[model samples]
Target: DLTPRQVTLRDRTTIATIVPFSSRYGVPPTLLQYLSDTMNKEIEGGDTYPMMDTMTTDAFATYWFQNFGAIMLLGTYASASAVTEGNDWATQCLGSFYIKPNYTGRSSHISNAGFLVTDSARNRGVGRLMGEAYLAWAPLLGYTYSVFNLVYETNVASCRIWDALGFKKIGRVPGCGNLKSYPDRLVDAIIYGRELGGPLDEQAGEERFDKIRFYLKYGTYPHGADRAEKSRLRSAATHYRLREDDVLMLKGREVVAEVERQWGIAREVHERGHGGINRTTTTIAEKFHWVRIKETVSDVIRNCKECKDKEAAKTAVVVPAKRKLDGAAEEYLAGSEAAPSPALRGEQEQMVGAEQNDEQFHVPASPPQADKTLTPHQMDGEPYYTSLEYSGQTPNAFQTEPHGDLAPVHLHADAALSLDPQIMGPMRDDFTLGYPQLHDSTGQPQFAEEAFHIGGHEVGRGRKWEG
Candidate 1:
């Protein structure tokens, strides 16, 4: 809980008292509901908060007061002890804020806070009073640093208050905030950070893990850094330990590559049969730590020329199915001068139905949602190849599921190396690059380039696309 402080109203003479309540004991239900409604109203105004949908009172309470309750500013000038709420929270409160750990475990010392001032309290300086009090109370609550991860650039007042209070702009992301006010345009978001009880490093340490490495090497804080700088570094070292004097490990997993490993890890996971988005993201997340990782994986899949070629291959294969249907209809009608009897028609339709259900022509059934997430490597299964070329000498045509189409799925270049010598011989002799007709490994009957093997599977991005 925060100490009672006097916050002057817009008139300057009218002083309002601010008080805080702890979440562990819980705020009153009615008051929490009132605050929820006020915050929901602010969300709808489309100026401050970015959340498009309003939350229920219970959800709002859990979000705001779940970790740390809230510091509430009273509207009346009457001393905090002299006042009591006879009506509702709306009439009694001017503003409120909650402070909680922004990141869990090792980074728990760094706190994040959300602020709200009722519409009636605008221009009354209640916000600044809360900010000043926050600077004092956050450290008291055990936070060493405060990070405002998504302070919208459009929120000029909030930016000014943070700037005036000596918080540094640690980072910025472009066009990341899909704000309601700017529905047609995405807005940039600023990452603001400050030491709770002292000044912040203007550079934000230049590198995230550098100080940890330095401290681990020397058994002390960085040279020439002040008390605040040393304190920040000390806090960051909590989750990390030197496993091999050079390698950093968190718990059991190696903490690697702040930015260097994102693309390579995303690509490696992606190139394993070009799995779906969920598979690609989950595999990397389990082993690596980095910012903007999900976005990176999304970019890899979205821009992959090989995957795009596979998409176009789907369209190419469907045309042959239509031709097969026309050819089948002509063959069924030939030699029959008159309409066949219903019994005969029924027998012919049954035969066609049996042919449709044959494994070679049967369309592939969708795997369960759970199975879709496991990449071929994770499942320890082989990549099945889709039929693009006919194997006249062996049983390599569409056998898995064929409805005028569908084959054994697809084989990656790595998997192709395991094929029979006879099959491999023909594949090698005819292999050429530049978007050749080959199946996708995603179990979908489609064409793909770059992942195909011509003579045999070669390492590194599978038969590299020559410029």
Candidate 2:
């Protein structure tokens, strides 16, 4: 009777094992040598000849020397408890998959692993156990994730095993593996990704908006200032003013300083002018007077009267003069006498009444005929005085002066001028009774004397003036 020996596998942390490949399976030296030769011939005849040649013992030793300070070879064994079978035993060689720290980024989320099983160990779950042990030990060795860069899609068993062990396909490359013997018939290399509890969650929209707001407020993106600085300033004007002192603390301090400089310029403009800069009634200085800064240094350009007049002329409207009292009605009232007369006592009464009426109800006399009908000279080209009247101790004493070329004069005296009824009754009266005449009907004035020239010679005067 024979008892089967239990098989156990464990990790070896150092390169102490030098187990020969043939000795592990209990084969004789000659048979093992023959097996090695046959395996070499098979490999040389296969498409993996270049790979097999490259993966020699010397190459493995060089790889270990270059990569790790030490290498560990693990094993699995099975034995039968019987001397009749001449200590019949089975052994499998195992190689470790080492991941050194700091090979990638400072983050320990990435790791590398490799696994190989001997032909005698096929279908015995050795490879699967090795892979599972690697996955389980990687986290304790400070790896956040394990990435498998190349896994052939045609290798369905391995793909299923890795997929079952919480790894997902992340990327792929085409024509990567030998696919002729596989059912998929295509070489689709896959990248398996396993997340080992790092930051991996979808960012909220509110968080994104907050980031945008921060950039807008500070005039900077995540890295540095951007063109949105001005827009941010315009949007948060109040906030900018409130944080004016903190402007230097902002990320885009230069942009804020530029805006502040422009603001100072605007303030200076307002300080120098009656109306503020911004062309607005309000100003930054006036609005934010609590700030301790003095007025800004700048000059305001003034608008002259001419400019004002030109601007006013654009929309000015001409208005007609309004009539006050009618001139024709006033004239009729001046000429009409209110009362009348009779015989002796009645005559006296009438005389007294007339005097009383003359004193109390006196009216303006009709304007002088000379003034009313006097023709103006077209040659003199002088403006005409409208009407002439006199008030004085003597009749028409105030009418002494002729009308001036530029303006009409009104004279004052103690006595009033009385118009003769006979002369006033006529429409064509020569009312220049006591006044000296200055001009004739032909529009030639007596004062039309010659103008003196140099050397006492008068060249053009005394000649008829041309219009």
Candidate 3:
């Protein structure tokens, strides 16, 4: 009834768990199959790990298991209930890494680990979780230091994770990997190392590095009486770095933001869009090593006049007033949507026939229709609707109804539908009644529109047209 510690997975939502799965106890068949499969896949791709002579599952077991070390797994499940006695959840493994001795008994305190993430689990931030777990697990496993002997430079994701976790790129081996993907070129590999944040960091922060940087600078040991103390300081100095900027970095990563520089560094990070305490602290800790950084960030954020103002603004009530605009011409109401300028409007228009004299008559140049009109009875089985073509200036208004025998007729220009008396028969022609059998249907105009668009415009309200 042992329950592994659960973590909220990379998605920041679902639950993931980490557990120790030792080779001695034997791995679950499915989980071992997955681990071996993932390693072989990485080898075949010839980019992540070095290309090996034999990529068989047996080779993977020997390489990843016993002869090297034991594995720690980060895994998740479909549901909480799926976590059971048989370890079914391990099939959903996010990633697995082996922790083993980097050297024989004397230097075994320094451990090495190889990390592999499942293809299904790439880019889920679980790689970082695996890295973080390595730091924690390695130390508890009695290892004081950790190292990765050959991380390919092309493995940007792995480099980024270790960099953020404060692992230093201490050495490089140029053109070492004859990878399958790069048949003609040899890819360079880097050596990365870091203190597992173990007993070495147990000493007070300043008390630890101030003397180390001094020796790396001056080659003089601390003015101490005891041999053990001198030797310890020298050992610590090897991992601590002194930069050209005179900023002491441990293992090539973190620049310890000293007591004096702590505020400025924290403030500098806070000024990068000013995230709240946890965010600001996380950002600062990613690059700079400050003592009590979370507390330092909290103090900085508390004193941040900017954050306080923003907090107040979030809670502040908004007061609004009714808006009114005054003008005979177009005007905007205060804070309301302004009318679009003329350039922003789209003119809706189509081609029309050439113009002619108001008093003249002529034939239309195309789609020649007989220059004639039809009475209601004459259009019994014809294909004529209202005449579309017109001569001269278009009419002001179309009369829908007329007096006497001229009641309810169509009217138009002389070209398309001539107004000549012979053409404009004393009866309606251009239009015919749907129910021509009714005697009273003559009074009802076939169709009429009070508002019409002419020459790409509607007759204006007051005057948006020719006066």
User: Pick by TM-score: which candidate is best?
Assistant: 1
TM-scores, one per candidate: 0.41, 0.28, 0.39
Worst 10 residues of 2 by lDDT: 10-19
The digit string of per-residue lDDT tens for model 1 on 290-314 reads: 5445756765686466897899898
Instruction: Sort every candidate by TM-score, greatest first.
Output: 1, 3, 2
> Residue 195, candidate 1: how far off, in angstroms?
1.1
Candidate 3 local distance difference test against the native: 0.56
What local lDDT does model 1 show for residue 373?
Answer: 17
Which residue runs does candidate 1 get wrong by more than 4 Å?
A: 24-26, 75-84, 199-467
- Give one digit per residue, the lDDT tens place, for model 3 in 194-296: 9886433324334345556666777776443158767877787777778887677865567563443676787789988989888888887777774467856
Superposed Cα deviation of residue 27, candidate 3 (Å): 1.4
Global lDDT of each model?
Answer: 0.60, 0.36, 0.56
Q: Name the TM-score of candidate 1.
A: 0.41
